[model samples]
Target: MASSSTNLNAQSKFDVFLSFRGEDTRTGFTSHVVEALRRKQIQFFIDDEELQRGEEISPALLNAIETSDISIIIFSKNYASSTWCLDELVRILDCKKRNGQIVVPVFYKVDPSDVRKQMGSFGEAFVHHERNFPGEVRVQKWRDSLIQASNISGFHDSRSFRNDAELVEKIAEDISKKLEDLADPPNFDGYVGFNSQIERIKSLLCLELDDVRIVGIWGMGGIGKTAIAEAVFHQISSREYSNHFDGKCFMRNVREESRKMGALYVRDEAISRVLGESNLKIGTLTINSYIWKRLRRSKVLIVLDDVDDNFIQELESLVGQLNLYGPGSRIIITTRNRGVLGVNSIVYKVKGLEHDKACELFCRKALSRKNRSDDLLELSKKVACYADGNPLALEVLGSSLRQKSKEQWYNKLHDLTLISEPRIYKVLKISYDELSPKHRKIFLDIACFFKGEQVDNVTRIQDKPTSLRYELEFLADKSLITISYKRLQMHDLLQEMGQTIVREESEEPGKRSRLWDHEDVYDVLTKNKVRINLFDIIFLSIHP
Candidate 1:
């Protein structure tokens, strides 16, 4: 179960727990209500809250209900007759008054007059209980409580028959708003969705039709490309469907684990961890067989982060070793090259943050001094503009600007804007400094000429690029380099950083080139120029 703090900290979200009599109407009204909530994207908890014969509500369930933002009580005809239902109602109403738990009552098929007046079937049940018990005042008191509960001003009077989407929709809307108020706060928590540039990848990934769709997300260093893939991974991992896997595995970097840890090491470790073994050792072939057998029985969510595009064949071998997976089973690869993912699959090219989101993110980091003056706000936006929404650049500037005044902000912005040169490479190098030589070369080539390029391109570029690819991928994966879809397109900020590393590595400055620029005019004249860009480029060509 996810914590309330996580849902609350996330922007504009809420959780609702529905309290309903399962046997009476779970398949009918309750199912429709739950479906409606889902269609509206309202998160809710509506599992059977009933206790089994000799079971009582556990501490976990009670706590979960208490922590939830709102509770909906479905008051059907025989609701008050059941002691269990009555107890749940009492608890819900108590929480409503004390802890601000919102409780909405829906009188299903039962008249409000009969409930409040206690004159019809409601009165007979209480009367029989009184006569049969004779001396139990508790039964009489429960009857009075039920009558009082029905008289509450917010109780819905009408029956929720079939074909009431409009009415149900209105009630759901009201509940949704209350839940939002309780769940959302004035400011944002650190957790955010993938950057906009990475979102482009998600949009494209949704379009593929393969039974085994694979996407590789790739980018340069410190560009937040890996963060994007991780965000999506976390998102999908939490869904109920993810439980189909024996267990999801996150392989940090392919090379180190494959080399140092080894396939046997991973299989043994994963099985031990899942099955709770202190120390277990099996032969490599046996371990491999066990892993494949386990995978065949379960749908797995595997993330291979930071891979060498050149090791495409090695990747094929790994996936080939496994048995067939279920429909939703996914394997995500993050590399520095796009071509490694194959042309038949979807390819997502991650870029940098848009100007606005980058500005907001930077302000949160830079303007740590709570209160910002109007003058500072203007200056901060200017500084963010200079960063160009590149996460690396934003962090660099923001970290530098912490506790600084408006004048300092202007000074930094002016210095950055005065130069025509981009700062992505400079920002990325800070993260690259920590990588090994194998990873450094991988990062550089990917940043410059290899981004969105195929696995063959790396081998074509260098004689031993494939051998180095595995090691490079391992480094990038561990360091959280971006890899998704089949190819690699580093965030702009990371590309800039990679370019900076290339410049520093080379003895001569003139040797480095920007691949995106048009340096060869005659080649463009001879060729059609292809007009390759992001989605907008494709859209413009179609519209033009």
Candidate 2:
């Protein structure tokens, strides 16, 4: 029953460090556990004879325990008999205390009560150790390590599990679950205003609910909808529901994935991920049945980010496939379009950062140090105002102005007023360009002439009630424009970008599709001739 030395280097680096007595379970129970770990593709380190013969645990074994995120201590009949195994136990416990390493004790063919109390074989082993090395403090330390490790809630093979095979499977399953949790950490560095939003969303999640709760986060682009969702998802996965949920997955940029590989592909991938399977090729025709059957008893937390109308439809179909889910399951969707959310779902509208928050965000992005010169602070506040609380605009403008001189800041601010900054404009134009031709025309008209006009007046001007209504809905759904208090409302930067797009069409105002400038209007009127077709014209006569 002696264990042979195997000096194989860890293939993907060790994730789980195995500590056990080789002569007792190395050939039987421990071997089964190693095979299970291999099938699960879990990296583990188990020492052989070459490592076990030293006066103390080798540096390689100690280093492995220190580096590992998790340690599995297999306590068999004679596990505590060997001084080497006891040394490993002490080192593993040390790692658990200092490095936050997870320690899982599997009582193989041994009772946890016996291990904790140092009774039966464990007591006999301690007596033999004391006699062999009298007055040694190491024996007491080994006993303490065993008691501490055994007290932790872990798999008890003799009491619960039927056999070694079943025990191995359960151990592998627990390891996989813990590994999934350790994979993703919350990333909140330089992330501003995320906590309040996450708190609101968490309130809406109501994790106490047994039934599936779907929460929607809707807002315009660059408003931090996805960022908020990601932060919340990380919190839920790693903290709140880490041990409770059966599985979790965060599918990011769903719109991009849908465009790259259809909505059904995204749906399949999400289901596969939450189900802990990879390359699961379920056809769209039968995916629903497959998902429902697989997830029926499982509690999961899923986050679908950057969803759009098309992807939402696919998501609906995917959810429809699931017949039932375990209680306490939650799904969070982040989308720019409110209409994409289910009517019954609670929707949180993410708005631009408040003035103070916007200023803080801009300053953080613009200045390297916390202490700022008065002039730079003034310039930052002015830029924040120009950004109008848009997170992306603040970031882009702040980064562009970082380390620039005060005069350069003034020059940049002036340039921003005249034309939209390219980076900010490019992002704003995405929502604009997604509009249909009719919707695009309506958005342009609102941006150009009717931004603050009454909605009724704008509708009358357009003179197409049915088309205008539909286009307005489309524009609103796309987060390009808003109808508020019976008036058309649009983001200032969006309006500027729309105007810039029109200006780009023709350098001469007379040759453009729309004319709003005073000099251009005067020139066209004074010429007493129309050179080109004009979509609309506005003229304001001055009172002398």
Candidate 3:
């Protein structure tokens, strides 16, 4: 019943801290490593929430790593690039010296020499930073930290590490042995909400991180993008390898603002803080570049949550730059926009719950009822139809109706139509505005007459409506509405929302158009005997 975070905070024996480049391992090996730890019942934390303050690690982050029993550093190519990762590496080494905290290394794609001496691209990047901040103590510290981490034991070469699965088994076995050695183990009960979905995502991350392939999960807003990323992170961060890294996790939430001082910008500061450096030249390094550099040789999982469509481009240059820390280094990105999908990232479209699942969810919130009632079931179906399987809408409406009775449900149900308002209207209008004028006209016509009316009958009432079928098909493709067996059913609430917008847009007298039906017009039309008289009389609803 307690939240995982609550349980983790209450514990004194949190197990492992996972450190790595999310991009390199998110879709591949890291997932496998994390799953292995989870299977063995390890407690850990892996953060993908973007840092949001200025260029310093918050006190809370420092405490999380300090509290962990061990740190796992998955060294990939870009590990050295992130100052945050460098600082975490320093913390782990400090813990090693100060408290004998355990440290494990998975030598992803980079060599020990590279980490030890800062050779290859890392050396060049550091040298460039040293030059930029000439004679800076922080630069010297960064160099020293890299050397110290490279010298640690428990190294695994990803290039020569044949059979990723077998390697993962060995790693898991080693972690289990380490757990056996620990005097105290943390209590971990796992995460809440959609366990199977989390497991599936973790599997994908493991395979992707192991193979050093990129993977992305894309979907609509609040479709659990960040949640899935967080789930995969917890799965891996609890492993034995995580102890080798400095901190439990580094999270970056990108939704706040991509501008200066945003989450990504703040993560840079967090890196400096975590590294225990004062006034480090953090900004000279790109955030993603810094993340990659620090995670190069360490087994770590980094999460880039709520990324924008442009996140793919920002990471393209750094993908090949990471050390490929075998299967333990991973990055998971959560976004509502689908454009973030890339070749390195496997893109999964997260859909809303199916009807039955959504109905169950609705009942739990709406009626304080989980059991399906023969009578309530039909009303629930009608409400679900109005929601159109959107979990947020269903939950909101259900919560609103939780204490209401059957009569209240009936009144609301009667008002509910092929069209809806508040939520679906604005969303549909955005989609509708993108259409051509002819398409817009057809959409508006359907909202007015053809909504509940038989499509064929409505079409017959309008001259040349047959010519609009192509536009209608286009709208259907975009999921604006559904047409089936010549019976057109609007996405219930969306139709109402669109009708409301149309009504507002026609409020200007010069427009001389009406979207809603008024009783006065029906009465006038009924009283009129001739078509000219009908025209003279403005039946506001019928628009004759």
lDDT scores in order: 0.57, 0.74, 0.59
Per-residue lDDT tens digits for candidate 3, residues 189-245, read: 112234666677766766433445455777765345655666566555654433332
What C-alpha lDDT, on a 0 to 100 scale, does residue 510 get in candidate 1? 31
Each model's backbone clash number: 24, 1, 90
Off by over 4 Å in 1: 1-14, 47-51, 128-148, 151-155, 159-170, 180-364, 367-392, 400-420, 428-544
Q: Candidate 2, residue 292: CA error in Å?
A: 1.3
Candidate number that wins on lDDT, 1 or 2: 2
lDDT comparing candidate 2 with the true structure: 0.74
Give the poorly placed runs of model 3, Cα more than 4 Å off.
1-196, 207-209, 239-253, 263-281, 285-293, 310-327, 369-373, 418-544
Q: Candidate 1, which ten residues in sequence have the lowest lDDT sum? A: 1-10
TM-scores of the candidates are 0.42, 0.58, 0.40
lDDT of 2 at 463: 60
RMSD list, candidates in order: 18.6, 18.0, 21.3
